[model samples]
Target: MRIFGKFLMGLMLVLAVACSRTPERGGYRPAPGPGANPQLGDSAPHSWDGRGPYGQQVHGIDVSRWQGDIDWDRVRGAGISFAFIKATEGADHYDPSFQRYWRETAAARIPRGAYHYFYFCRSGAEQAAWFIRQVPREIGSLPPVIDLEWTNSQTCPYRPPAQDIKRQASIFMDIVGRYYGQRPIIYTTVDFYRDNRLGDMQAEFWLRSVANHPSVPYPGQRWAFWQYTGTGIVPGIRGDTDLNAFAGTRADWVRWLQARLTR
Candidate 1:
């Protein structure tokens, strides 16, 4: 009986050791890629002095799992005209909360779009296929977005030359555009804008300029959406959220969506 008891204890110890060695899934880890501002995109909320200059324009927000579970109804009530939700990143990772958020936003009557974080480490074609696989090509949805930014992590340390980066971006946009039947928007930062000379691309631009208007930083450049502040306070979002404004008025917003949907 003593020998049997000893064998049972040994079996339990081995099981415990095996469990300890298994890797658990990570929760809420933001992707290392373009279109997120590391300084402003942290998990915690940020403080802002006042709503920035684009208050008069049609406003919106962009979000991912990092924002935690969101109340989409409250967000719509906050006078948010639109939203861009993170759908996929790289070649394999899909945002864990994407399906829930997508359904909730649709039910809440807020126009929502899907965006893929472009990874410098992978081919743009592969990343686009990954995004296409995850995000359904739904009618009446806002156009897709390609977010490009420098990765601060060791996972993707190489910043290809300007031409190579542009080439990859073009390939990604082309494939995604073909699948969605609408041109994609390019979300980029000031430094990345200049580094890649993105003005040369045919895709509409979504520029991130927290301190100044995009026009100031991107002189003589036209932009479809300007992300004016990352520390925006909206009713539905628990923490500080990134805020954006369309370049045109409410009528323009309707017209824009109609054109995309019917085109």
Candidate 2:
């Protein structure tokens, strides 16, 4: 009897040790570390202080786990007017740097917003709730953003139906809208927008079209912000950083920040 009990104890220890091992990184989870902001096609830095690749007036940068440590003062000094920091995704997963960056951005007095990289498998309401829980109901934080882009992962493949997509979007938008008392900005790519028709809804858009500005394919399409390039070089950052120029002048940015009424 004693031998059997000892054997069971050894077996349990082995299982406990195995349970703590890290899973192999793949799609849906990029390895952590600093990332270089690669330069986009023919997209070189041009005028700043209120202009974009498409000549729009609003400028902002979206951050994720890939982008490593940043110096707040350097970013503010580099003419960055606003930023969207990654907040959360599924119920169990949240960005580690979200609150840190959000507080830093707000402390710098930069108009800052929070975003969630939606998982294809997560329901809209779940995503919304998770994000709400992750981002504190802080008075100074800017409006929240929803990043709806393609999922290039095996963990949660792209299998959601159109109706499901719409339902999910509605659930998330409705919750966030009610939470913030205004519609949250929708951040997406050209392909995702065309495939999902995400623009059918009424929220402001932060479009990503690294190739062409918002004018060519989306003619007459007014956008609140544009992400023209992934690769950017900003001083004070350890490596290449994504740089965004506001669509308008510094004054225009201030006006948007003032009007948000975040409280």
Candidate 3:
């Protein structure tokens, strides 16, 4: 009986240690070793050469109708701290899933924002007005995002001059800013950013750099969010989705939300 009691005590101690190491749902977990390829405990299939999205304390996804139906509860449980959903494009086109995604993310208690995909063929004021009509002016929502990138559309392939692009973007952002009472974030690709000199703009940035860290591609440009991968696989998402990381610690994320979230 004495030997059996000692064996049971040892087993219990082992189980306790194991349980302590298990990550809680929606809790932050440190990344694996620097040399580790890809991400050890993440669902990403592609490998990142440097400190990747997993290294960040706060991770999130940006989605559109292409993602199909999502299980928001599972996404939140899988450690998605926030979401940016596609709301509008051009002057008349609205994403069919915008309302559903907005509603579900809120129900899941995840901070959610809307993004407008800029159409070069349309005037910025028109596009901004379209976005304002579609997205609600919620108090706790994340600030709006304006996606600026070159498109491969055969019908609307007109690339405006750099100065023109900047002017239009400013108009859109300024109008949206007034409506939301928060400065908007500009989401841009590397080529678009460099070509348009977006760094000169007085707005926060969400940069896309999938090959390497944003610092490698963007150089000295400060960024609020870095989209590290577009082929990321998360728990609730059916197919690939864009994954992004906040450029701060967990405490910084809390502070940012307090300061930057819609009033």
By lDDT, who's the top model here? 3
Candidate 2 Cα deviation (angstroms), residue 205: 0.2
Can you write out model 3's per-residue Cα lDDT over 146-262, one digit (the tens) per residue? 999999988799999999999998999999999999989999999999988888999999999987889887889999999888877778888788988899976687668767777
The whole-model lDDT of each prediction reads 0.74, 0.63, 0.82
Off by over 4 Å in 2: 1-58
Provide the clash count, candidate 2: 10
TM-score of each: 0.79, 0.75, 0.87
Please write out the lDDT profile of model 1 over residues 126-228, one tens digit for every residue.
9999999999887667889999888785787898998999999899999999988998999999999988888888978899987676778899889889887
Error of 3 at 5 (Å): 54
List where candidate 3 sits over 4 angstroms from the true fold: 1-26, 33-46
Higher-scoring candidate on TM-score, 2 or 3? 3
Q: Rank the candidates by TM-score, best first.
A: 3, 1, 2
Model 2 weakest lDDT span, ten residues long: 25-34
The TM-score obtained by model 1 is 0.79
Query: Which pairs of residues have clashing backbones in candidate 3?
Result: none
